[model samples]
Target: MIGLVLAAGAGRRLRPYTDTLPKALVPVDPAGEGTTTVLDLTLGNFAEVGLKDAAIVVGYRSEAVVERQAALEKKYGVKLHLVHNDKAEEWNNAYSLWCARDVIAEGVILANGDTVHPVSVERSLLDARGNGQQIILALDTVKTLADEEMKVVADPAKGVRRITKLMDPAAASGEYIGVTLIEPTAAAPLADALKATYERDPQLYYEDGYQELVDRGFQVDTAAIGTVSWVEIDNHDDLNRAREIACQY
Candidate 1:
């Protein structure tokens, strides 16, 4: 399986910093050994988990990633493949992930470019691979649920019953932390779901694609990343929290 990262979002809320760079390139560890982009942390985690081959979907000032590709490869010790998302700035990540269908067909530990989490999250997913779930998500069951978070409701016997950002916070069991393990059997269906999701609504998130798969009778499971420090960098506050937590790794 390869490591797949969705790094195409424009992150309009993070202006100035995102003016010339994609959100994945935004520095989270400013005071570390050198600058550390969210992509850096992601690739590093994947490498640590022995996923040496990785594919990154890029758009919205994608030149920045092209320029840094070699350096990032050298730094993380992983082979990097680039997938272009033509509608990155125009559509949401459902399309961004679908753009990588060709590369991730074998299988993938898919991560969002904007999230910062430790290698433990990757390890948990890998360790649980024997559980035989087709698609497994890294969920933060310990965190407080909020409306903006991608929430999930799991059935003890059936696995994930629902996953979405629109679910009522009071009813959610946990938040999906943008990390997923998609086995080969589920990749094609996931790509189809993602395609259908984007076709239905360009603004919908890739989580909606998971909802589609679940609705189609696929069992999407979850692995709890208990009390792990992580943040999804969406705005200034999230970036600050990422900076604080990223250095801990």
Candidate 2:
């Protein structure tokens, strides 16, 4: 499966630190706890999952991102595919997804560059592929989920049916982790929906397009990922938690 790393966010909250570089380029050490850098760990984790052919969707100081990724590819010996999104600063994660639409034609795994997730989660997502299922978003039922984290409402029984998207912090039952698996068939529909939304409202997030697919009849499964070590680092607190968790590996 192809691995698509969304490494384009500007990380506005990260301020001065991010003023010079993308958040994904921030250091994260798996062995030393938040000491290494997120970009290294993210790429290394993908390699550990048996993913060799990987793509990184970059924007917002993409030059730095490209240089870093190139160095990583050489050091790790993993094939790296670079795709650029000029409007990364204007759009959401969905725009990054759109940039990689053509390059990825089969089953692929999607991950955010600024997050550290359990290695097993990536494997489970790739294993959950089936017919007519274009995307399988990894989710876990946590006691407290922040508003910044992506949340979703899923069916109680099937565990595969996703009812709706939840961005409001107060009205959420589960938090979506950083990674998702997508099949080739679901790309075009998602892309088309996104284009329509972009034309209508350029500020819409990528989830809007996913919701559009759901509204137009698409089966995007929600794979339950319970009790996993998944953390998305966007601020100092998240970085602290990432450091604590990284040491456990």
Candidate 3:
């Protein structure tokens, strides 16, 4: 199985901080002598999960990010491949993910570059492979769901039956922890659906493609990661909070 780190976004919410540097390179905790960048932390976590071969989809000052990650590969002996997204700003994360579609096989873990989580996504990947499911998104029921965060709606069985299109500040109950374990065999069909949707309605969110599969009776299960700490850097406020979490470990 291969691990894909999606770091191609322009990070509009992060503003001036991401103006010069990619969000993955932003230092999460600087108080300690051995402070690590979000990218480094993610790599460390992936290493812990026993995922040594990885690829990063980069954009928005990709040269700098590539250089830093190259040094990391040399220092850690991890295979870090960089795939550039030339039009990252025009597209959403799903499109960025498509940039690396050729490399990702049937058993692959798709992770957001700006995320750090306590749980190893390796187990989720294993579960998906063993089950031979089309898709399995790692979900955590947050105590408080914020207005701007991505939310999920599951069935009474606690499975993610639908990813809601309605974006309301009051309708959310669960938050996605930036880890989506995808089956490579489902990639072709899923990507085809996404292409059709994107061509017809460019404004539609990427998850709409997944929902289409769900609506068609494809088994897109929700694997719950109970009591795990995870953070996705969206803005400066999130950065500060992630810094606190980083210091705890």
Best by lDDT: 1
Per-candidate local distance difference test: 0.90, 0.73, 0.70
TM-score list, all predictions = 0.97, 0.87, 0.86
State each candidate's clash count: 0, 4, 1
lDDT by residue (tens digit), candidate 2, 47-143: 8888788888889878886766667887666788889899888877666777788865655788888777777777677666654457887777764
Ranking by lDDT: 1, 2, 3
Window of ten residues with lowest summed lDDT in model 3? 119-128
Off by over 4 Å in 2: 30-35, 156-173
Residue 55 of candidate 1: its Cα lDDT? 96
Candidate 2: Cα lDDT at 104: 53
Decoy 1 TM-score against native: 0.97
Q: Write the per-residue lDDT of candidate 1 for residues 1-249, one digit (tens) a residue.
A: 989999898898888889988999998985633389899999999999898899999999999999999999999899999999998989988889889988768899999999999999999998888877899999899998888999999876788998988889889889999999989888788899999999999988889999999999989999888899999999999988899998899
